[model samples]
Target: MSVTKALEGAVGWLTLNRPDKLNSMTRDMVETMAAALKAWRDDAAVRVVVLTGTGRAFCAGADLKAGNGAAAPQPGEKDSLDVIVDFFDTLRNFPKPVIVAVNGLALAGGMEVVLSCDIVLAAESARLGDAHSNFGVFPGGGGAALLPRKVPDNVARYLLFTGDSLTAAEMKTYGLVNEVLPDAELTDRARALAEKLAGKSPLVLARMKRVAANACDKTTADAIRHELLELRDHKRSYDIQEGLRAFAEKRKPEFKGY
Candidate 1:
């Protein structure tokens, strides 16, 4: 399996299994991940998702030599590019929080995946960059468009133009990475964070995720209005009432994710 999935507690973990190839993504891997996200999106049992890779590299990018190599779709059929785009789209729109554990190198399409995630935890030694310029391959998974939004334009341009990788620490300083830990501690730290998020009300988290994402695309006033609308709707949710009741009772809230 190019991708492996496991459900632990309230977290759904997705690991890229092709270490020998730097866990480079193939069409099948993209499809598998997309399908997994689709399943987890509606699963109340899964309150959070963590994505990582095996071996020395998180992901070097799409496999250039793979069978599906960027070929244009024929007639009605989809191609590698389409599959990759859909995968990232699914990840970006995932209702629950999606965390990325960058264990090592993440370049090109790999970097794009990082951009799509809600939170990112990286190993101290991990490196990230956009390598498409080095090989004349324009990013098909949002590297050019999203990087600037994540970091300063100059920083994004340097990474895209130079195709040079930056240390995890550097990315953290640029605000692209949430935290950087020792290599051996990456997995545990990521799991800990995921578990922390899992303890929250799933319905509240889902609503917050939607509002936050929409805020990114709207003006300040529009975003505030959107948030107000969501809040108005959420006022009637069972989880909100339960939370308030729990607070009044000085006890933990048992959320049903309604």
Candidate 2:
């Protein structure tokens, strides 16, 4: 398998497993990831998700060698590009919090995957960038859109034009990476963060993600209204009452994810 899925407590871990190839994504791998994410979406036991890659590199981008960046045919599936589009859509709207553990190099589509996550924890040795220009190909993996949103417009353009990679520390300065950890500790730190998020109220977490995402595409007034509506809806959740009661009683809250 080019990808692996595992669940630890309330956290779901998805790993790109093609270490020798820097875990470059193949069509089957993307399909596996999409299916795993969909399954976990409704699995109440999974409250958070962590994305990472194995070996020295996270992902070297699209498997150009995989049929010239075109995916081989799969039953009931469109072309590789379509599958990749769906993968990014799923990640964009994924309800649960997702943390990307950039264990090593994350180029082109791999960097896009990192951007799609809610939080990014990168290894000190990690290198990230959109390198499509270097190959004389343009980014078609939502990088053009997502990159600008994550960083300054000019910086995104610079990266796209130069096709230069940035170290984990440089990415952190751009506000893309949440933290840079030693390569040896990247996975552990990412898991710890996921565990911490898993301990929060799942209902609240989902609501926050929806409202925040929705707000991004709305006018300020509309965003405020949407946020208020979501706040009202969240107020009715059982978890809120439990949280308040727990606070008053000086005890830990037991959120039921209602």
* Alpha-carbon RMSD to native, per candidate: 1.4, 1.7
lDDT, candidate 2, 1-258, per-residue tens: 889999999999999999999998887898899989999988989999999999988998888888485646678768877888889888888999999999999999999998899999999999999998998877767888889999888989998889999999999999999999999898889888898999899999999898888877899999999889989888888999999999999998988899
Query: What is candidate 1's lDDT per residue for 57-78, written digit by digit as tens?
Result: 9999989898544567789998
**Candidate 1 local lDDT, residue 167:** 97
lDDT of 2: 0.90
Q: After superposition, how far is residue 227 of candidate 1 from its true place, in Å?
A: 0.8
What Cα-based lDDT does every candidate model obtain? 0.93, 0.90
| Candidate 1 residue pairs in clash (backbone atoms < 3 Å) | none
TM-score of each: 0.96, 0.95
Q: In model 2, which regions exceed 4 Å deviation?
A: 69-77
Clash pairs, model 2 backbone: none
Candidate 1: list runs displaced more than 4 Å. 67-74
